[model samples]
Target: MQKKSLDAVLERLMTVFAVDSDSELARKLDVNRQTLGSWRSRQSIPYALCVNISEAEGVSLDWLLAGEGEMLRGGSISPTSKPAANPQEDAILALFRSLEETDRREIQSAAEEKKRIRDIEQRLEDLTEALAVARRPA
Candidate 1:
């Protein structure tokens, strides 16, 4: 995997930390806002601060350095995050994730199919009960 440039790393860190600007990042890193502004504008940031950002955001150091590995340690996918590991599971998750975007629409459709068959059987019981009730003395 190609190593991500320092700027790219910082950008991801900023996004992961949910900070809108480098000044906010500097505040979190306990560094001067001017230093962070220079770093972001010039594509330079301290290694120590990088490490701090990774630790604070639960990112793997390796992934931060290179985009090859999972971004999050726990393999969670944020709105801007990418997939991490378990190739097989990832494929399965992709399928489920690709399902039509509705409230359990796939599951509900399958359940409705099953319910149709169940309703047929239930109607027989209902008919039998109705006949028994009709045949009984009033």
Candidate 2:
């Protein structure tokens, strides 16, 4: 896999949203075209809006954020992969998905913060945990 820049993210989003141009994407996202250009210039997108699109459009957050998975929910990079195999995990995910966007975001933020603290305490990966691998050993 190659580097996933903001341009790639935006391009993937355009593909998902079926927009032919940035102007059309901006219109669909309800932002101004200049605002979209500014995002391209800064290489950043608002977290809340990304979350909104992921949940509302039934897309995968992993794909939206890191380009690590299929564009649709419950699918990752691996063709045979399943999002959740455990029944308890499936139930919890169902509950999480039922929450409002703001609540879901609060939960996600808190979970990330907790992971950060754990990483520091355990001397594991960095605070961002970007280097953390969640893969199951073969």
Candidate 3:
């Protein structure tokens, strides 16, 4: 799957939490305000936190990461009960399940780096748009 922007993922998180500010998100996550600010400034999110939220709550990881599926899994499925994983997803899950703990940690680190870069790119894009708007005459 094509990687989604970190900013977009963050927006989805906000939608899930019904929050409009980072401070609120931080509070809901049980993290300090500075911690959240650090993550935003550094452009790196804690993958484990997202995973914990997904498992502890009923939220869907696919929707949080790639925005591919519904907001929730299991009981939140449609009336007919949509399948959780497609064939490709099934294959990936099988492989992922077989991996060593260290290997999984490596993959998680790589994902965090990718998300950091995506966040930076999104911030740059937003800044560029603001600049363009500022240059426009009244």
Q: Which candidate is the best by lDDT?
A: 2
In candidate 2, which residue pairs clash?
Answer: none
Every candidate's CA RMSD: 16.0, 14.5, 13.9
lDDT of 1 at 43: 63
TM-score of each: 0.44, 0.51, 0.50
**Residue-level lDDT tens digits of model 3 in 40-83:** 76676788888988887678998777667666766364756676
Which candidate, 1 or 2, would have the higher lDDT against the true structure?
A: 2
| Candidate 1: regions farther than 4 A off | 1-4, 40-43, 74-138
lDDT per residue for candidate 2 within 66-93, as digits (tens), equals 8675668965357556454788988988
Clashing pairs in 1: none
Can you write out model 1's per-residue Cα lDDT over 1-138, one digit (the tens) per residue? 122486566656654554646687677667798876677566666677668767887887777765457766766557567545788988876775566423233444566779988999999999999999999998
Candidate 2 is scored at a TM of 0.51
| Candidate 1: worst-modelled 10 consecutive residues by lDDT | 100-109
- Residue runs of model 3 more than 4 Å from their true location after superposition: 1-4, 75-138
Model 3 clash pairs are: none
